[model samples]
Target: MLWETSPNSTCLHAQREAFIADVNRIQADAELANARAQLRLPSSRSLVASTKEGKFVAMTSPARLAVSVLVISGCRRHEPAPPLIRPVQTTVIRYGTAGEPVSLSGLVQAQNQTSLAFRIGGRLIDRRVSVGDTVSPGQLVARIESQDAKNTLSSAEADLASAQATLVQARSNEARYRSLLSTDVIPREKYEDAQRQLAAAQSRVAAAMASVRTARDNVGYTDLHSNVAGAVTAKGAEPGEVVQAGQMVLQVAQKGGKDAVFNVPATLMRQSPKPPPVSVALADDPTITAMGHVREVSPQADPATGTYVVKVGLDNPPDTMRLGSTVIGSVTLSPQPVASIPGTALIQIDGKPAVWVVDPATSAVVAQPVNVVRYDSASVIISSGLKNGDVIVTAGVHALRPGQQVKLSPPAT
Candidate 1:
């Protein structure tokens, strides 16, 4: 029953069966590789296949080959990242045609502050006014113990009474001696002696009168009075404290004008003798503002702070600008052509001031030495370091070195 099979047909069937087996093997290998990939395992670089002619050939799938290359390369050490290029804010230098304005902290004060004190020294018995109490002209502000003063007055009055009695007796004796002399009942020498006694008594009476007046004044001085209408700003003495003559008992701020007081540096005080008007405003609330002019400056600097006291008289200040209130004062110097820069841009080099200047062509920063005329809170006046067109890095100056490369921030929108 075995029919003779054709040789060509046998060969063809064998080839077809082998090809189908190879295709199935390839599919299985692909599945295994996909599963390994899902499990995050390494995949083989190539697969082996048997051709119909019974020869083995190497085959690499495009997806698996790409993944294998990536994995191998990733395992290798990475090169270091590029150096960081920092960005910085910058400003173009410009010279001020007008003088720069300077601002300082100040305090509101009374333009005419007068210290109320006793003309005579005594123990303070009663203080009629406390701090911040309103007072009027000739108002009694305080009083000292007047017992001693009254005793002194009583003694002066007794001396005056005695002198007056002696004067009356002397006048009577002189008149009686004159009448006796006219009637030849007494000698001329006696009348002259009576007249001389009367003169001496009159002189004693005059001196006693002066003593009484002085005592009266001392008694009146025991009660301290305010010469001007104002408010009591301070108290230097309390009840039961012994105070000296001319010692401050109460500080009264007169009702007329107000002043903004500031402590200015000696360098600033050496400028123009007469400065321009100052703008004063409340420290917490700037909306409450006023204008003022320099009314007085201390002839000598303070020994503690080495600063001069400057008083600026305000023009019609608001009621809320009371004495002792904190305020801000601003003064503009006379116009001069000077260059100034932000304080942040200024850096120190070898104990001298310098700045980071940007090169327009290379965008590199270089430390250029600068001569600073003065330094303020927000700015520095340049005497000879920077020019009008020089560009300087305003921020992050401390982080940079000479010849460092930097990127400029875009100008503010």
Candidate 2:
């Protein structure tokens, strides 16, 4: 005898309530702080506990009354969502009309990429960020050996003070000499010399001020910093390494980094599709999504490539992408008529682009493969497909092959 399967008469939601309560009690007994906890809905399903692994540690999933029991490290917890009853299938279909816009391929670049270096040559005494280190604007990068710079600054300050003192003394001497000359107690030449000394002292003071400026500038150079917020793509010199003025020390990619290039066909350009927005899937991490923008479009097209070069700029490039990562992305830009059809309507015949055309008169879809010029959001631009007023199977197109009979009504309506 064969047993027929049917939906359970009982709702799992009511039964699971008691099970959930029991799980909660166990969690409380474990003394795990109820950090970010939630009960799974009846329709949803989940184990009592789950574990997540990180760079340094791992947390095991807790067991539920229905499933397996587990031990976990007491640390942090995730903001849990309502549990899912069963695994759900997920798919993403991106469709767009062809458009034209600029494209750039690059790592996440700072708006203003800058390299911090010393104003004067010195040994690097400290470095705050290494390659792949993220830094904020005005954050320190490194400091140069500044003992010499400080000494020079100190000496200039002392000279300035001494010159001022000399100026005062010279003025006093001049005044006394003038009085003597007027009274005929001293020769006129001596009075002139005293006046000259006063003038010299003033010049020395001005010179000292210039020296101070130089010294102050030198002191500032001893400390290097990033001018903009971004990750350190490269390092110039290590700590204790000597660097000279104007020497390149580091390379940084500005946020919204490098450009993505695309070579599109000239015929497609005529359609004038909107430029494709860009995103990146890094070689190191294909799962993480990144945002980017089209930055450039070359008017000229290369016949050999049968396309024009378009560039895109990426935002928030991961460390892997920060140092110039290779990535591939789509540029959805085309000019054509839009259509919304079931995914089943698409068919390829004779290794050429084609689609099935459904005729309302006969209630039949005929294979009429046409050139798939480009894709629009939720539709496709067919330059040589079916004409206006032509309809085709939107659903279950895959089930029917070429020259196969199709029924008007199916059981799974």
Candidate 3:
């Protein structure tokens, strides 16, 4: 607003015209920018103009100074350049293949599974093993009442004694009979009857001995015994319960060699080739990753879930990865060639896999979508939407836009 009004008319008129032209140029640039912004288009504010035959006219020679001062001092204002658009140097891959790692999840299971049962039936009088009880091979676990077996043993002893007494009497009578037969004191028919009675008594004794042996076996069967070394995992019958023959009274499990089973899509499981290598981590703590190999892959899928049973056997299994412990398995499908790149380069475009490719000419960034087949430990496999050598944004997606300037950074070692 403060200015000196000069009385020299021609010079003042020339100066006013030059100032007006400068103002027009600034207005034009602002209008152009507003229109481009409305269309969401990008353009640089740098102007390049050349005039070969310049007209002889009074011009604002200090146009830059005038523009800067007016704008900063609020006398005149100029539209600004878009905020410094920096390119994020990202690593990327064109569509290609590489061997990649995969992992699957599973839970620990007892490998040697068995249900402990009784062989013969009787009242369970005593039970030494309960849930969580440990036992060795041939260890007695429980016992049943054997009153009938004891009675049978006593009866068999009486039969044997009676047979022995009858045998002695028969021998004495035979001696007398032999002497009598030489004279006529005793008849042959009487001696023959006595011999037949003694033979019958001997047969009865043999039958009783067999019965005693059977009774002894029955008595032995009344005591429940363990046949393997393991811990009792379950107990269905109590001491007072009368379990029948071959009933599951206890469940024992061996101490080591556990496995994990998980259901996977049928397509993922391959039976023709050897099963894929896999790694596992406990769900409670994923950092504790345990290496494992595929133990089994069921040929069929579960009808309800449409998944095949995939078993993984662990090595150096963590203490936390115990039986019934939840775990996640990364089942490695057979490795195929894939483009390996750092994970920082990945971005999402259109709600799908995407990355920013560096332009060869402009050195600007342009978004490109990609299909991530899988994530290896150090790199990623892209199934599609990339090239083998195309430069991609690795570190900065938020700082990027189309046609943005870039600075190349060294790849990570």
Candidate 4:
């Protein structure tokens, strides 16, 4: 090609060579820049080595290198820790019988308590029984001063006697007057006057008889007697104390049946369809238990306590069961189908009661709304939203999230 080549062709060849040379030069300059950058930057291994030595012998200043190394280490350390799977205790829910038994504190009392008082007012003269004294039917409990009663009775008797004498005389006069009128020995007006006198005398006699009876009754009332076999619980009068009619002088508790009296909430009374059977235990002696049944329930709620007074009659109460002793009554209700779980399993979501339900296949938890029937001391009774064989997170419920994987811990020993 060089042998006798044209000038134009030679010039084109020289231009092509110059273009190739410029491209080579540019490429070489880029490579050199890249090398310089690599030398200035600190590698991971080199930085670690520099940290161990507490100094950097590389082209870069030690301060810059140290800062870069710390930043890189911080990034590596802060890289989001792998999400941890929490281990939680769980329980398998099953449908079973559940009921709320209302327990109440009550006092043991006699079924019949009587307050004895005088039917007539007078000064109390004698008290035959003291508090805690056992008494029998017809036993004298107390007596009022009877001197005034005796005097009144005597006056009534005297008046009755005088009235009887007058009545006898009047009868005799009436017989005589009738005879005289028939025989025409006296005027008709005289006979009529005699009949009127007899009638007035008969009225007086009748009045006197009534007064006598009333006086006798008043005398009898001065003596107070026990109507039932019982023990005296209280005494309101002492000798020489003036008492009013119908004022309570003593309180007697009858000896037969005992009752456990409780003030129960009105809500409990409404919820129970019928009076539930109860078991009573003495607060002082818990070992002493007796069976009982509801005897009475107040129709109206007490305004002060907002409760109803309930009386449970004890069956064959023991001798040791005394009046005024404290007792605890426990009642059991009919069984209902419900799911029972520990209280820890319950959680609230969106201001509503909920529970965490675990998916058996994926071991993940999801919040589920539940109808809570009852909240007991240690457990909760669920009425709806779960069925038999449902696994629930009984523990670690507060630290759970929706659709979070978990591992079931071993059951507690």
The window of 10 residues in a row where model 3 has the poorest summed lDDT is 50-59
Listed in order, each prediction's TM-score against the native is: 0.68, 0.43, 0.47, 0.61
Q: Which residue pairs in candidate 1 collide?
A: none
List, residue by residue over 9-93, the lDDT tens digit for candidate 1.
Answer: 5544554554466567667776666556557666574465555864445465677546544543444445678866679998888
Of the two candidates 1 and 2, the one with more favorable lDDT, higher being better, is: 1
Model 1: residue 147 alpha-carbon error in angstroms: 1.3
Give one digit per residue, the lDDT tens place, for model 3 in 1-413. 21124444554555566566767876676566556655766547634232355312222336675754454344322566775756456654544343344555566877786776767787888888787778888898888778866777778778777777877787777777778887987888987877787777677778767877877787778777788888887887898888888998888878787777787765455422365556788887889877777777787778898988877778878777777788888754555545767777777777887778888787778888877765756666676777677888778777777777787776433
lDDT of 4 at 127: 94
State the lDDT of candidate 2 residue by residue for 127-243, as single tens digits: 877878777777777888889998999999999999999999999999999989999999999999999999999999999989999998888878887787766777778877889
Tens digits of per-residue lDDT, candidate 4, 1-413, equal 22123235555455445446645654554455444445765343222223353343333346644654453333332346776688999888788775667568999888999999999999999999989999898988899988888899899989999998998998899899899999999999988888898999899999999999999999999999988889888899898999999999989999889999999876567556486879999887889999999998888889999999999999998878788889999986566677778999999999988999989899899999998866777988777989788888989998999999899875432
- Model 3 bad stretches (over 4 Å): 1-105, 152-204, 263-266, 294-311, 335-413
User: Which ten-residue region of model 2 has the weakest summed lDDT?
Assistant: 1-10
Q: Which ten residues in a row have the lowest lDDT in candidate 4?
A: 42-51
- The prediction achieving the highest TM-score against the true structure is 1
Candidate 1 lowest-lDDT run of ten: 1-10
Best by lDDT: 1
CA lDDT of each prediction against the hidden true structure: 0.83, 0.60, 0.70, 0.81
Estimate the overall C-alpha local distance difference test score of candidate 3: 0.70
